[model samples]
Target: MMYPPIHLPIVKVTVLEDRALVERHAEVVLSPGAQLVRVEGLSPLAVDRSLQAQLTGGSVAQARLHRAWKQKPREGSPEGKTEPRRRVDTLEAEWKRAQVDVQRLQSRVEVVNAAREDVLRAIAEFAGAGEARPESWHEQLEAVRASTTAAEEALRQARQHAERTRQRLVEAQAALAQGEQPEPLLVTTAELQVEHPTGGSVSLRLTYLVPCAVWRPAYRATLASTGGGESVTLECEAVVWQRTEEEWKDVELLLSTARPTLGAAPPRLVEDWLRLRDKSEQEKHTVDVAVREEVIQKTGEGGAHQTEELPGLDDGGEALTLTARHRVTLPSNGAPHRVPLFAFTAPAVSEFVGHPEHSPLVHRVARFDNRGPAVLLAGPVELVRASGYVGRAQLKFTGVGERLALGFGSEDTLRIVRQADVKYDTQRLTGRRTRTHLVKLFLSHTGERPVRVAIEERMPVSEVEAVEVKLLEEQTRPPPTKVSEEGILRFELAAPPRSQQELTLAYAVASSAKVSGL
Candidate 1:
């Protein structure tokens, strides 16, 4: 989206040719923060409405104007005094130009917010049971996206207002510095009234730009070995927002750590939900009066009060509802900013646009390891379907285009291959601090000699956290191997022997963090 340039008129109104108006003794108060460099007046800045609205959502609308004002020297002014007026003239023009700059500067907050939302959605949606989806969170996540958007809009306005005030002051200052009092400056109150085409402009608020810093140490675990082992250094990086740098610079706590929540706070998990049993209210109790010859007594000490049914109980034979919530926090001034609770809602439907939605290519790829030689993955699944599971093509990778369909290697498929292997590259995630996947490899044999095979991956980093493996699908048994001995989940099926009959290896990883650079 493009923002129209701000074009405020220099608005030179000729003085009433009366000598009295030009007479001295007029008190001139110069506006502050004016500069020199531009003349002929600078243009005002503009913003793209639709784009800003989309970025900030429906919550806050940003209204900004150019910050600088311009003034020309009067004809027949004193000699040698022209030096400062010349300077002021140049600055007035610059002020006009700076006015145009407001949009560019303010737009960044919107861009960052939009990016943050997208990233959050991606993380939740792609978080796979194993690995494959691009980001864990689904884009359809319903959230109170208001606060984040507001913060961004407020920041933009703060910047624009500050700059505008500075510009006006600069013009007034120039007149004073030049040894002449400033006449009553004419400011168009109409322009002072900020107009939002959407008509939803919120009252602007003051904002401060603070920097955030983030860092992760470079270290690796020492493996028990006879020789001196090596280590891989985890690189460090950080991003700066207003106050973000100050807050996150020393973040050492692991966000992964959490205490168990009980009662209402915790959502229903799979295990606890299973132990439920039903008690039927179908049977009713009756009271019988005992008659002792002539006189009868209503015995049985009263059948007690009839039990009232519980309110809001539905007996449609429907299953209990399952809802879970998760919150996402970003780096703030020394504390993580927790977003409001978000539900683990089912796939969403848009009546305005029919049908349920589909995720990106990451979901299209799936793997069925223990089954047959080839498990056919159907087509038309969005990336959401194959997100985490890998192994799209036997040898190829998942390229740029959206992943529509792919298949997994079944147990039968493994048996058929004379030689098979799985391998892929891994790196720390960039931009946000979230879970990241790492790489580890292992191998073993039980029969005679060692085995030689091709261990590999499906695609490149174009699709983060995806793995693809192609091997002899049908196998009677795997080469004997224990995952415990292997440092991390990884394996290499060799090409030939020095190896044995069968073996199995497991591979997995966690979130890689991305951060801005200092």
Candidate 2:
């Protein structure tokens, strides 16, 4: 049966990591009877199982998705192709140009080599000619030597040029070969049978998931000193890309963390069998997890949540909504289009951090608590300071009240010199060995402005009870402000302009038996 064409416009799109879920909504006038509605122009990569439709002014009795390959006529046929044929033609032209270059270079090489050979023959003749013109022989030999040297240099250059041209030709040939491949055409159509109560306009929503679409988070962090506190402005953006063969024009775009490929139902538990096999008959089986496809049901849950104020609607536990302020037009060109999602400002703590033992350069860092109502998705961040663009850093998934540290490259204003001393002693009575490490950092602030600084160091924590560790607090200067259970030490201090400060850390490790880790 022929279905009436219902051109649905894409209204919203939720971009995931590797796929996209598109929602199309349109109003159609229907009669008070069963009507066949056909929605076309969908992504060929759309998942058949994920197709869903809803009729508001009508009831959808039946729905089915159909996909077919629509072959385009080859070049030089009555029906012609556009993009694919043009691409192949462009590549062919490039290949022909490269071939011409190769031929030209080859000709030049032959000419250069012939000229070099002629020069060498002339030099050989001059050397063999005896007493014909003894006085003129010296001048002729010098002239021949000059000509031979020039010809050899010219031949070497020409051969080098010829080799480079040959490489270019090979690359062009490969590109042309790839472009010559036949292109496949995909046509997707969704057929729906709807029953309407009246003959008015009826609204319908069609949703489907398609592959080859992805979005990644990116941020721009600007920090400037404001009075005693530092003001940090974080601009959150999304880098969206797709190759779904369907362009999204003037649609509401959303970046989500949904994984629909992983199904919702929990995996059924399988019985584990244990058997003892003979050594000679024993075999090993390798299980591959790389190719395993996981379909996550209810993947819309816990997607990108809004920061600061909570979203009115929750997908499940979290409702991270990064909706574009205005409608955006994104093409299916497989290129990344950056869209600014939102921006927020918060107070932060700016400090100069130094880990002289590990790296000699001191870095300026800003630590701030995520007080915004939205959760920050993990993405790349570009740090900007008052002095301009500092550098780029990666931002991890952070929830509310979580702290994030943004490193702004290196701080050349602060200089640190690290000195470490090791002492080994043997106990005479207990016969146990002991090792002590004394590390000192001499920090000098060379800049004209005073700044806050924090220094970090680490001590090896013994996992076994046999090994004992002790911290010498008396020998340590500017005592550690925080010490993690993992033996990380942090010290916060202030550096005056053109002044110097020193940080000393001392620790001792003792073990009765020789320890493999220290």
Candidate 3:
């Protein structure tokens, strides 16, 4: 026999990068025999194969999902209206009442205008006939003027009221139009056949996966200056977007970085073969080469595995799950809602960083370590200072105990000037080409306090034996503090109040005659 449909309310939701897993729970009394139970009011986007049900004090023999149509009550029907429908009806009625008020006030204004015109006509006729004394005529004219002025004042007030009512009516009509959208009629339902020898109250939990739900990582970094030093509060949040046609009210939320749709099976492999051939007569005579910039694709920290599709924010070589600190209520409006996951505060070191080759302005930078339990995903972070929101910057994937730096904004009190000079010469006997570059940077501080600045510069790196690159240490006055193998020069400087500092860098590039492009 078929039993009555049960009411299962959503209790928990686990949101992933592309979908969500919803769980519902309910308890009902059942008879001590086999019966069919149905649970309705599920989102139509629920996956059929992902439906699972568990029961206590009983066992489920079979469970299947099917689409069911739920017809809504028509306008003015006996059944009650839904919340949105009721709101639309209320606004519509208010709009009609407002329209009536405007019409009545407009009629009052018209009547006042017509009466004033009639009184003026009567006064004109009486003056033309000359049937009264001058004083009497004057008194009648004065009375007519007084009454006409009163009528005009009343008309002006009535017109103002009408205009206000008209505006309110327009607003009400707009609200009604916005709330009149039709809701979906189709819904997914689960039907389960159960068996119980002796049943009283059976608790059931239903879980299913639904699409149209996605989440991404977001952060907010607030830098505060204290007596001890500067500290940064990094707040991690998840921005969720869903249109599952079901409201998750006060449900436990769990955000995951797993992509179940991609599957776990490895990709198919294909054989790769390499072959070599002898050079032609034209290539053997001279070596042909060209120089071009190479583009590098960043796969994240530790070089995460590459996928066919673009990587997500949490594509940092591992998967992680984070639970919300508090229960969340998210509506299915297809808009983004932020849920706070966790936050941590750490001591930050503030410094000014400059790359004169790119920009003349120096940026205020903050360095801090991630002391949180989980890895911080790469995403856009909103930077806040003591004054207010400074700017926005991107935070790379950072693991526990790893340090990261963010730039708040450009420092206006500090200025940088950069100049470069280049010279090319050819050796008389060797025919070797040499290019020399002399670079200078001037930093000026206008503030009352001393500040430390870090400068970065890049030098060309050669990968071929025919090309040589060297840094002229003797020629460069006050040389760089450190130089990386990849040809990056770093300089640290201290600028006192109202003082100036200068730095110079000299480099040379020598290419052999066989190197066609230098």
Candidate 4:
């Protein structure tokens, strides 16, 4: 039986990385009788078991959702198949016209060829059997030659026109073929049979899990530093995309990271055996088989929509949830829509870092702590300094009170020149060798603002007891901070405007058996 269409407007959406849970609200005015109320406009990809209805001011003893494909009417139906049929008719007409044009051009080409052959035959007859004449014969021969050449050119032009017409016909035929495809049988409604006790203007909420809706986390970090406060500000944002064949207008949007396709059950384990291979074996056996399998299962209720506690979340715990502060409207056109989730500023220290072994350029780095209550998810972060957009970096999952360093870009105002020298000496009596290495770093800050620079240097760790390495404290400048036992030295330097500073590091390696690496 054909029932009246139910209008269900999306109310809330819980978006995951690749899927979303959609909820809709609709009010039905019943006549205080028992009847089947059908809810239309649900996603065709919606899980059948996930279809649920919660009613207020009424009680339902039995509830079931029936999904069926409804055929299109001969008249204008909601499926909108008339436009495609019209397009197919138009393409067919154009294709027929193109075919007629091609045929006409081909006929013209044949006529031109016939005329050329006739001229050639006339010229051959006149040259072979006709009597020898003077000026009149020469004039006639020239006329025949000119006519023959014109006829041949006309034939070539006609053939080219025919080819062009054929190409048009091919294109039109392809378009007509595409347009002639049968209209898909789409599921337009889900008839809900609810055994109601008593119904009177009930507000019904229908929730379902649909595929093709996804949301990903994107961040934007904007830095602002006056060079005297020793702190920088950071901002973050998110981008979401959905195409669930339903418009979420003025809806509460909640984003989560969940995998529904993997199902609630864990994966089954397969046995794997390890065997020793024979070095001289060169035999193999192979088998091939074709198999096709399909399994359909009803999906249970997905994750819930997150409302609060999103601001104080750390990287640990269960899945995180971020809710939009305001209502969001996303059409079912499969497009990316950006929404500002939250923005907070944190204090950061800006410094310049350099690695002389990789490049001579110094990169601007920002060391910031997650002082805010919200945990920043791992995603691509675009960095923008006070000057302009510097570069892009990846923001790993950071918890509260966790420190992170991000590279802003290369700095040209700070210049670093590194020089190194190595000398080796051997002791003949003990068969020991001493290798001395000295490194000099010249740092110049030409900018108008003073900056902090951190230089990282690496020292070789002795793997054997016969090798001993020592750092010369008298020759080194600026004490190291938090040096690791694995031979890593970090030095923090304060660079003033228009000033140059020199840093020296010297280390000696002594090995009893003359080590190859120093």
Q: Evaluated with lDDT, which candidate comes out highest?
A: 3
| CA error at residue 339 for candidate 1, angstroms | 23
Model 3 CA lDDT for position 189: 77
> Could you give candidate 3's per-residue lDDT for residues 277-326 as a string of tens digits?
99886666454555665433343322223444656645565678899999
Pairs of colliding residues, candidate 4: none
Name the candidate, 2 or 3, with the larger TM-score value: 3
lDDT of 1 by residue, 389-429 (tens): 32322111111121211222221112211223443344544
* Least accurate 10 contiguous residues by lDDT in model 3: 295-304
Every candidate's CA RMSD:
39.0, 15.8, 7.6, 13.7
lDDT per model vs. reference:
0.28, 0.76, 0.83, 0.70
Error of 4 at 153 (Å): 18
For model 4, residues 34-151, the per-residue Cα lDDT tens digits are 5667777777778777777777866544445556766544545555545555655565675566666556656755665676567567667867886555566567657666765765
The clash count for each model shown is 101, 18, 0, 0
For all predicted structures, in order, the TM-scores are: 0.16, 0.67, 0.77, 0.63
TM-score, cand. 1 vs. native: 0.16
Off by over 4 Å in 1: 1-88, 91-227, 235-240, 243-492, 496-518
Backbone clash tally (model 4): 0
Q: Write the per-residue lDDT of candidate 2 for residues 310-392, one digit (tens) a residue.
A: 32222244536678768899998999899988888889887788888778888987888776657777667899998999889
